[model samples]
Target: VIRGFSNSRNPEKTIRAYIQMLKTGFSPDHMTYPFLLKSLSRLLNRKLGGCLHSSVVKTGFVWDLFICNSLLHMYGTFRDRASARKLFDEMPFKNLVSWNSILDGYAKCGDVVSARQVFDDMNERDVVSWSSMVDGYVKSGEYNEALEIFDQMMSVSSSKANEVTMVSVLCACAHLGALNRGKKVHRYILDEHLPLTVILQTSLIDMYAKCGSIGDAWGVFCRASVKESDVLMWNAMIGGLASHGFIRESLQLFHKMQESEIDPDEITFLCLLAACSHGGLVKEAWHLFASLKESRAEPTSEHYACMVDVLSRAGLVKDAYDFISEMPIKPSGSMLGALLNGCINHGNLELAETVGKKLIELQPHNDGRYVGLANVYAINKRFGAARSMREAMEKKGVKKIAGHSIIELDGTPHRFIAHDKTHFDSEKIYALLHLLGTWMDLNVNNDDSDDYHCVCS
Candidate 1:
C-alpha cells in the first residue's frame, strides 16, 4: 500500500497511511521506509523528509541502498546539494545509482558546473550519465557546450545516444539556428530509426521553422499521422507557420485542429493571436481574444501582453492604453512596454512618459526602460529631459548591455559589434560590404520593377 500510494498522483496518502501504521504501534521495515522516503521526495516536504531521515537512522535503514537512493532523489529535487553531497559522501557503499542520483541533484538544481565535476570523477558511465550532462548544459543555455558534449558522446565515448539525448541535441541545434547541423541530427534520427515520437517530431518542426526552412517544417507536418498528432505537435506547426508570416495558413490549421477535436491550449491561442498581431489583423485579434475568454484555458499575463502588442503594432496606442486601464490584473512590464513602443511610433509623448516611469518602477534594474524613455524624450524635442534620463540611469548604476549579432557561417559563429573591425576577415568583408552598399545606393529610387532596393516607401 505504501509503494502503491508513493507511485500514485496523491503521494500524501502514503504519508498519512504510514502515520496511521506508526500510531497503531506497527514498525515500518527497510522495505516500507524506501516507499515512505519516496513519498516525501515527491511531495518536496523538506521538514518531513528531514524527520524521515532521522527515522531512517533510528530504524538502522539509512544504509539500505533503496532508501538512501530515495533520500538522495528527494534532496536533489529540493536543490539541497549540500545535504545530498554530505549523505552521498557518508554512504558506506555506493553504486552507480547512488552516484547518478547525486549528479542528477546537482544538475536539476542549476549547478551544472558541479554536476560536470561529478560526471568527470565517474570511472564508468551509461547513457543516463551522458544524457544528464547534455540536458543540463541545454537547460543552462550553454548550447555550444551541449553540442560539444553530444559530439563527444558520439565520437569520444562511442556511446549510443538515445531518444532523450537526441531531444536535447535537437533543441540546441534549433536555438543555434544551425540548419545544416540540425539536418544532420534529423538524418541521424532517421538512420537510427529512432521512434518519431511526438516530441521528436515537434523538435524537428521547430528547428526547421527557426532555421528559415518553413517548407521543410511543412513537409514534416504534412507527413505525420494527423490522428496521432498531439496538441504540442499541432502547436509547434501552427506556431511555425505563424512565425513565418503564413498567418492564414496557421488560422486554417487551427480550424482543422478544431474539426479534429484537438483541444486548443493556451499556447495555441497565443500563437494565433501573435499571427494576427504580426499580420496587422486588429479585428481578427480581438475576436481571437474573445474566443480565448470562452475557451477552457484562461488568459495569462503573457496572453494579455500579446493583445497589447496587437493593438500597439497596429498603431492603436490609445486603445491599447485603455485596454490596460480595464485589465483585471495589473499591467506587466511587457504590456506597458508595448504601449510605450506604440506611443513612440504614434508620437504620443505624454502617455509614453507615464508608461515609461511605471515600467521603471516595476523593473528598476532594466536598462532598456531608461533608454526607451530617453529615446521618446529625444524624439519629442526635449533634449534636457533625455539627458536627465541617462543621468538618472547612471545614478542608479544601470548599464546598458552591449549589443551584438552572431552570424553562423561555415558551421562557425562569428560575433560582430557595430563598427567593429576585429575579425580576421575584416578587410575582405568590408570590401564586399562597401561594394554591396554602393550597388544598393545606385539601385535606390530606381523606377524598374526588377530593382531590389527601390525606395518607393
Candidate 2:
C-alpha cells in the first residue's frame, strides 16, 4: 500500500500508510527504504532524508549495493553531491551499478569532467554507462562531444546502442544541428531494426524537426506503428511542423490528432500556439488558447505570453493588454516585454510606455528591462525619455550584460564578443571579418539590403 501510494504520487497517503505499517511493528526493509527515500527526496525533506540515511547506516546494510546505490541516488537528487561522493568513496564492494550510480551523480550535478574520468576508468561498461556519459555531455551542452562518444561507443564494441543512448544522442544532435550525424543514426535504426518504442519515435521526430528536416520528421511520424501514435507523438509532429512554419500541414495534423481520440496536453497547446503565432493566425491562436482549459491543461504564463505576442503583432493591442491584466499568474518581465517590443514594432508608443513602466517596476534591477524600455523610446524618437532611462540605469548601478555569440568550429565552441581579444586567433578572426565585410560590400551590396548589415558586429 505504501509503495502503491508512493508510485501513484500520493506522498501524504504513502506516509500515512507507512506510519500504520510502523505502528503495527512491521519494520521496513531495504526495499522499503528506496521508495521512502525517493518520496522524501521528491518532497525535498532533506532533514528527514538525513535521518533515514543515518538509519540505513545503523542497519549495517550500507555495504549492500542496492541500498548504497539508492542512498547515492537520493543524495544526488537532493543536491548533496559531496555526501554522495563520500558515500561512493567509502563503498566496499563496487559493481557496475555502484559505479554507474556515482557517474550519474556527477552527471546530474553537472560535473561532466569527473563523469568522463570515471567513464574512462571503468573496466566494463554496459548500456547504462554509455547512457550516463552521453546524458552528461548533453546536459553540459557539449552536443558534439556527446555524438562523438556515441560514435566511439559504436566503434569500440558492437554492443548496440539502446533507447536511452539514442535519446541522449538525438537530443544532442537536435541542439547542435548535426543533421548528417542524425541521418546516420536514423540509418542505423533502420538497418538494425531497433525496436521503435513511442519514446524513440518521438525523439526521432524531435531530432529531425530541430535539424530542419521536417520532411524526415513527417516520415518518422507516418512510419510509427499504430500503437505509437500517442499524445506525445502527436505533439512532436505538431511541434515539428509548427516550428518549421508549416501552418497548413500542422493544423491538418492537429485535426488528425483530434480525430485519433488522443487528448492534447500542455505541450500540444504550446506547439499549436506557436504555429498560430508563426502563421499570424490570430483567430486560431485565440481558439487554441481557449481550448486549453477544455483539455484540462491550464495555460502557463508562457502560453499567455505567446497569445499576447500573437494579438499584439496583429494590432489587437487592447485585447492583449486586457488578457495580461486578467492573467491568473503574475506576468513575467518577458511577457510584458514582448508586448512592449510589439508596440515598438507597430508604433504604439503609449502602450509601450505602460508595459515599460510595469516591467521596470517588477524587475527594477534587470538591465534588459531598461534596455527594452529605452529601445522602445528610441524607436519613437523620444530621445529624452531614452536618455533618462539610461541615466536611471546608471544610477541604479545596473550593468548591461556582455553580448557574446558562440559558434562551433571543428566541434569546439568559439566565443566572440565586442572588442574581445582573449582568443588565440582573435587578430586572425578580426582580419577575416574585415575581409568578408569588404568583399560583401563590393560584391553583394547591390543584391542585398541594409538588413544584412545587422550582423556586422
Candidate 3:
C-alpha cells in the first residue's frame, strides 16, 4: 500500500500513505525513503523533506547510496544548493550520480560558476553530466559557453550526444547566428544517422532559418512535413519564411496549413500578419487579422502590434491610430512605438507628438523615447520644444544607451560600437570601409550623369 501510494501520480496521497504506515507501527526502510523523498520534492514540501531527512539519520540510512542521492536531488529540485552541497560533502562514498546530482542542483539554482566547478572536478563524466552543464549555461543566457562545452563534449566524450544536447546546441547556434557551425551540426546529424525527432527537426529548421539559410530551412521543413504534421513544425517554417521576406512562400504555407488537419494557433497568425506587413499586402493583412477571431484565438497585444505595423507601413497612420483606440487590450509601449516610428517616416508630426507623449508616459525610463521625440521636434524646426525635451530627460537622469552590433566571422563572434577601436584589425576594417564608401560615391555620380544625359537627349 505504501509503495502503491508513493508511485501514484498524486503527491498528497503519497504523503498520507506514509503517515498511515507510521501510525500503524510500520517503519519505512531504505527502500521506502526514495519514493517518499521524491513525493516531497514533487510537492515542494521542504518541511516534510526535512523531517524525512531527520528520520533517515535516526534510522542509520544516512549513508545509504540511493537514499542520499534522493535527498540530494530533492534539495536540488527545491533550489537549496547550500544544503545540497553540505550533504554532498558529508557523503563518505561519492559516486557518479552524487556528482551529477550536485552539479544539477547548482545549475538549477542559476549558479553556473559552481556547476562548472563541479563539472571540472569530475574525473569521469557521462552524457548526463555533460548535458546538465550545457543546459545550465543555455538557461543562463551564456550561449557561447554552452557552445564551447558542446564542442568539448564532442571532442572528448565517448558517449554520443543525444537529442537534448543537440537541441540546446542548436539553440545556441541560432542565437549567435553561427551559420557555419550550425551547418556542421546539421552534417553531423546526417552522418551519424540520428533519428530526426520532432524537436530536433524543429530546432534544426529554426537554426537554419535564423542563421540566414532559408533554403536549408525549407528542405528540413519538407522532410519533416512528410512524416510529422505537427503545428509547431509548420509554425517554425512559416515564421522562418516570413522573417526572411519570403511572403509569397509564407502565405502559401499558411494556406496549405489550413488545408491540413493541424489548426492554426496565435503564433501562426502573428507570422502571417508579419509576412503581410513586410510584403505591403494591406488587404491580405486585414483579411488574416479578421480571420483570427474565426479561429477562436483572441488578438493579443502582439497581434495588434503587427496590424499597426502593417497599416502604418502602408501610409495609413490614421487607420492605425483608430485600430489601437479600438483594441480590447491596452497598447503597450512597443505597440505605440511602432506607430510613432511610422508617423515619423510619413512626416505626420501631429500623430507623432501624440503617440510620443503617450509612449513617454508608459516608458518614462526609456531614454530612446525622449531622444526620438526630440528628433521629431528638431526636424519640424521646433527648437525650443526639442531643447525642453532633452532638458527634461537630463533632469530625470535618463541617458541614451550606446548601440552595438555583432557579426560572426569564421565561427567567431565580434562586437562593434561607435568609436570602438578594440579589435586588433581596426585599422584594416576602417580602411576597407573608406574604400567601399569611395566606390559607392563614384557609382552614384556616374548614375546621376547618365540620367542627366538621357534627359537632355
Best by TM-score: 1
How many clashes does the backbone of model 1 have?
Answer: 0
| Residue pairs in clash, model 3 | none
**Residues 167-233, candidate 2, lDDT per residue (tens digit)?**
8988987887767778878788879888888999999999899878899999999988755578888
* Global lDDT of model 1: 0.90
Task: TM-score for candidate 1, please give it.
Answer: 0.91
Candidate 3's C-alpha runs over 4 A off are: 1-63, 74-83, 86-92, 225-229, 282-299, 440-457
Model 3 lDDT tens row, 1-457: 6567666778778888888888999999988999899888889998988999999999999999999999999999999998999999999999999999999999888899999999999998999899989989988889899999998999989978888888888998998899999999888888988888999999999999999999999998887754376878889999999999999999999888878867899999999999998999999999998899888788888999999999998889999999999988999987888899899999899999999999899999999999889988998999999999999999999998989987899897777999889998898888877876876787766654554222110
Per-residue lDDT of model 1, residues 204-252, tens digit only = 9998998889999999999899888999999999999999999999999
Off by over 4 Å in 2: 1-52, 120-123, 155-159, 394-457
Could you tell me every candidate's TM-score relative to the true structure? Answer: 0.91, 0.83, 0.84
- Of the pair 1 and 2, which is ahead by lDDT? 1
> Which residue pairs come into collision in candidate 2?
none
